[model samples]
Target: MGTQERKALEKQLRRSQILDAARMLLFSSGIDSVSISGISSKAELGVGTIYFYFKNKDEIFAALQEEGLALLYSKICKFIEKEPAPEKQLAGIAEAYYRVSEENKDYFDIINYFLSSPRIFFEPGLKYQIDMSGHKILKIIQNTIATGIETGVFKEAQPGRFSIMFWGTLHGLLHFKKLEHTILENENHRDLYEYSVNKLIDAIRCQ
Candidate 1:
């Protein structure tokens, strides 16, 4: 390989290394607890080196949040690929959402942080990118509902609002379970997610 290519590859690797360290710190401790020095310690790199890659911890947080959303968007798109049946497509999408929470708990926490503090995305270009990534994910749900309506499976109504209702319901349940309260504790705790999905499907279906 040429010297230029080697240098470019190394630069990308270094950036990824820094980002990975920041992600670990953010997940282990809340975003408020993550600092440049802490990230440096966790990354085994000097504080100056971290600053060289990221202007500050906020920049790193934005980058990590963007990456998490992009990954989630990709996963849902892959799951929904070319399925003509809208109901089945929604089932897959719902399952994908549950899988993300179950499998990528760290990313999930980062997303929760993002939702709690949306003002962080106010930076001009960053907000656009983050919003576009989120829009893509939401489009999957909206499109599924639109298709279901066309096929007479879903009740005819506003697709956008229906999509929000579906997503909001699931989001509410997921966050509720995250609380320390024992109200959600039961033998079938794990099954609450499936129950939510089934109830949502029933609610949206044509009567």
Candidate 2:
């Protein structure tokens, strides 16, 4: 590649290295314990280099969140495309979400961490970007529900409101997974998740 292109590619690689390092630290230690210097040491790069790519630990964390959300959105889109019917598409979306959590635990953990901690804050622009990424995912669900209604597969309702409830229900169920051995010792977590998804679908399905 040309000199400029090569330099750009190198820069992107460096950024990925930083993010990877931060992700490792996040997994090893809680976010409260993560720091810029720790990430620099973990990546085997200078502190200045870490700052060159990211302003601070928060920015690095936000970048990771953005990456995870983008991955989720892409996966959801692909899952939706593969299904022929709107009801099936919603099921596909739920499966895609579970697969992502299983396959990308680091990303999922960081996203979950930030989401559960409302006290954590980001700059307005950064927060907006992350929020928009999330909104895109929700919009897909809302649009699919609207399509199902239009086709007479689902009952008429406010797509936006229902979308929020649907997403929140799935997310909440997934979060309860940690308590499985205690609270759900007699139940299969995956079965419970699928059952919840089906119930939600049934609630909206035309009678």
Candidate 3:
């Protein structure tokens, strides 16, 4: 409520503005084009002001990862909950993962930055937080497998191995789906995702 607190809050808001603008550009285009001055212009702040909040481009990107991932994690949680069963929950989680990438490709690009282009992304905190926070998605996978096994919906299966395999398979499918231009017109894209999940679902089902 004091004048000093109000001033500090305003400063924080302006810095957040810069990060949001930078994230937009990074997702729309790519990180190669996002210069300090460029982000300042988009944010309607001064380059000096951006530097005041962030030491360099690396810091800006890290903050973007933090903020954007929070949005994405919320999306996954919201979508996954809409499903009614453990099997549908697994399918929903996989679908929600793709939805996040399509809806907020910026955050997706930030995650893929470390995977695809390793040069600019080298922050330890970013990696640690992402993996830790992403554990929820993994937990969903584990729970789905456990449920399937328990109810004989999925019987005599390697839940741990299924979790890893399912995630790895979907991640690769999505990565390539996003990367290639020609893959755009493929009619089976949607089916492929379903088929991928169903393959594992079938593997675990009582047979």
lDDT of each: 0.79, 0.90, 0.75
TM-score of 3: 0.74
In model 3, pairs of residues that clash are 148-154
lDDT of 2 by residue, 15-128 (tens): 999999999998889788989989999999999999999888888988999999898899999999999798999898898888888898877787787777767468788898
lDDT winner, 1 or 3: 1
Of the candidates shown, which would achieve the greatest lDDT relative to the real structure? 2
lDDT of 1 by residue, 25-82 (tens): 8778877898999999888889999989888887898888788787777777778885
Model 3 regions lying over 4 Å from their true place? 1-16, 24-38, 117-120, 178-186
Q: How far out, in Å, is residue 50 in model 1?
A: 2.5
Candidate RMSDs in Å, in order, are 2.7, 1.5, 3.7
Q: Could you give candidate 3's per-residue lDDT for residues 157-192 as a string of tens digits?
A: 777777878877877788767535575565467677
Predict model 2's lDDT versus the native.
Answer: 0.90
| Models sorted by TM-score, best on top | 2, 1, 3
